[model samples]
Target: MEVLLSLVVGALVAAAIYLMLSRDLLRFLFGLILISNAANLSIFVSGRLISGAPPLIEKGQDFPVGEVANALPQALVLTAIVIGFGLFAFALVLTLRAYRSLGTLDTDEMRVAEPKDPS
Candidate 1:
């Protein structure tokens, strides 16, 4: 099961990397989302590989040690997810504006709009 998870995580990371290299803005955005998810999965898998464990401390238990998955990685992943969401939203808006202004999604054709000067 752990091996399967690792394989799936590796594939997702690979696909995310491939998507990130594409030239399309939308593809790039999607790549970022994929990358973020892959990272979260990686973090989750790295810590003890617990299955269906709660992250809460039990009552009257010393040190609160249990078969719980590491909460640190989960917290980190949550933070990363939030940050990634903000970045994705900002990128989406930027892409939309660029599309509206340039009338195209091609990066090659979306060069900076410069003003014409006449002497």
Candidate 2:
């Protein structure tokens, strides 16, 4: 399972990079989302994938009886997910506004700093 997850993460990262290299702003935003997710998945996999027991102790027990899942990675992933969502939302809105104002979603053509040749 870990090997499979590693493969999946690798694929996602590859796809994200491919999308990020596109000339389209929207594609770059999508790549950002994909890469964030890939990072979360990588963190999750690094924490280990155990199916033994939950990360909770019984009422009488001071510690868990068997192997328990790590809570740190889960918490980290959750936090990352929320933050990523917010960032993605903001970027999407910003991109839409830029597209509307600039009349183009292509990164090269949306350049306002570099004026086009009059000729």
What are the candidates' C-alpha RMSDs?
3.6, 1.7
Q: Residues 27-50, candidate 1: write the lDDT tens digits.
A: 888988988888888887777566
* TM-score of every candidate: 0.79, 0.91
Against the true structure, candidate 1 reaches a TM-score of 0.79
Shift of residue 10 alpha carbon in model 1, Å: 1.5
For residues 1-119, write the lDDT of model 2, one tens digit per residue.
Answer: 99999999999999999999999999999999999999999999999998767878899998888888899999999999999999999999999999889999999898799988899
Most TM-score-accurate candidate: 2
Query: Model 2, residue 21: what's the lDDT?
Result: 100
* Model 2 bad stretches (over 4 Å): 58-62
Q: Lowest lDDT 10-mer window, candidate 1?
A: 110-119
lDDT of 2: 0.95
What is candidate 2's CA lDDT for residue 25? 95
Cα lDDT computed for each candidate against the true fold:
0.82, 0.95
